[model samples]
Target: MRKDWCEARKNDPTPTQMYYAKNGVITPEMEYVAKVEMLKPEYIRQLVAEGKLIIPANINHINQIPMAIGRAVKCKINANIGSSALASDINEEIEKLKVCLKYGADTVMDLSTGGDLDEIRRAIIANSTVPIGTVPIYQIIHDIKDLDNLTPQIMLECIEKQAKQGVSYFTIHAGFLLKFMPLVAKRKMGIVSRGGSLMASWMMKHHKENPFYEAFDEICDICAKYDASLSLGDSLRPGCLHDASDEAQMSELAVLGELTKRAWEKNVQVMVEGPGHVPFNQIEFNMKEEQRLCHDAPFYILGPLPTDIGAGYDHITSAIGGTMAAFHGASMLCYVTPKEHLGLPNAKDVRDGIISHKIAAHAADVALGRVGAIERDHAMSDARYKFDWNKQFELALDPDKARELHDESLPQDVFKEAEFCSMCGPKFCAYKISQEIAKIECNDYPKEKK
Candidate 1:
């Protein structure tokens, strides 16, 4: 370690939090995360040191509010916000970020492959208080028309640009090795990841190993310099329910597991990304297997939709699988929007996706009884039982929507506190009817001997 890096370097250039934690140095990020997770600083530091948790705050991302993802803390949700070649703009992407964060998305990834990619990332990072993640290969291939030109050097350059620009983590698909290609040959949907597919194609054309895999150490050096976490993208993730947990996906996971250890050696924080879609029954198996194979490094999984027919309602399918995955120990969920497989999402879709995953993560937390998870649910139930409309709205997952629907039918100012609403007139209200039944029992008490 350099002397200047310790004192004169604006911040402690301790390589990464994992480095400090492993060395028993509780960093500022760790202390901040301990407060948010309601855990002792030592506990947070220990788990992070052991590669069981990740605080994906890059040293350069000054505005980021530190977050914890692992088995010990509350499960986190990530929303994808970016512009495709067809729709490319900055303002709308920022709007989407606002919507996801408002609905409680723990992190956001900019998968922009169009427009001013650098500018889009800078704007999102500047406005975002939460840690931002990105895929470097998206931009490397975005500019180079032919896949032949996409080399290891270009990829590293892209990673350097984003890492220095306050990006907290990267989704590098170095796990997409050449041998896994033939395994996905028989799948229903082959290679769904844009970066993953581009990489596979590039490797096939050059008859060479994946640049990301070959140059992974160089990549680690860059990540360590900026304290960026590695999200080890699942390039071979299943695209449909039938393809879930297949040989190709498993092989990629094994590679990711190996890469996780390599990243740790470089003091780079690491997490393994999981499936695109999986059957309901296999979600638990996948989550557990990833934890076992990755040495319990934080597992971040996409919705892994349990059904393939759910086009417009993919958010529902995603939540179904996400619930089981999180319950089984997956630490982070990548939200799937209602428009999945149909079109890019708008702001409302972003809200819907995040709310759906938030429900899944919270339900899992409650099931695990982690810390203070159950209290919020109990509070909501109490509010409903007492007919506290405002309290009910406040306790709801989507408070604005809850308030709007309640006021739609019972618009009067007096109805705000009334025990009855438009759902049922006062005569049919269940709580009121129960009260009347009790009154009847009191009034009709058997008479004493006359």
Candidate 2:
């Protein structure tokens, strides 16, 4: 359906939604996002034109259902799934995609570093209904093998190929410059990002500036052709609490701001990726800095985990940070699963990660007072007060899990309507006693005035 929409505008120089938005045309993509976000179509278009939001609807991604990410919309979550050098297959990645969709991931990034990268991405794009993203450098380095021999042309070629394959966004690590190499010496983790580390090693070996930074204009041209948005990768993002909000991270962020403008100049949509680990106290400063530095282009961040010790439960830690990040103005939260410092995430890990970030995003929405954000919370409160178990389960983020835990105790249809669970029992139920109190009908209570 979107293919037809782009077909009609085949003669246009740029196929980007931002292009159409800047021209005062509200494309069908904007209307679709408006319906989903409960905002006016014109408002969506205005945000897109102003570079405050991004609708990553690549023209070639015909199967994609457009979604908006920005401060004006509800905070979004992204789940990363792909094959690494050791494990996972096409079928496994597909299963992960299904889990992401089922549990409310706003987007999915195919970070497959091994196996058939092209085939895996093609399968992911063909099967995905949400915007698909990738780091082209991963595939480029995987194919090239020898970092010293890698060329700018090869990098652009890989990115363009992925763009044509319906990748809705590319995480280009343009901010990691050659000058920042010395700064890593002062850090504990050094360069933690795979993309960042690769770029650093290549630059050191070749003694050249970041190819992505130098070739950014060409990359923008490619993105403009396919309407794929640019997710400026944060190569210098703090990897640990000790490194949080340091010089390396801040330096790269400044460059991200410059790249954001450069991409926007060609009418390419842009969102800047942020830090990997940030203390809770610094999340607000980091978010606000992105707004000021990037000129309000959407900010997407991974865990930004506040503490460093929650190794196994980093998902929970990140969710705690994610809430602060979103509340402070982050547009999207990339989930970190329990397997995060341990290993690759399985389908169950994916589900757990998505639910945690989903809750974080929703809580941020409620805290920010986005329209109707708290209505569901209010509904859940009412359900609990009335002892409506089924309704409570229905409103839960993970209904099956909620129902499963409830059944572990009750496990009977008779308890479906029972006024109390095993926790309180009918005799000790506060809800039951509260209802009885309402019926006391005290004569001293004030009566309605006539």
- Which pairs, if any, clash in model 2? none
Please, what are the lDDT tens digits per residue for candidate 1 over residues 129-207?
8889999888888878678887778888889999889899999989998877788788888999988998888888888
Models, CA RMSD each:
3.1, 2.3
Model 1, residue 285: distance off in Å is 1.0
lDDT of 2 at 173: 96
Task: State in Å the error of residue 197, model 1.
Answer: 0.7
The model with the greatest TM-score is: 2
Residue 74 CA displacement from its true place in model 2, Å: 0.6
Taking all chains together, each candidate's TM-score versus the true structure is 0.94, 0.97
Distance from true position, residue 146, model 1, in Å?
2.5
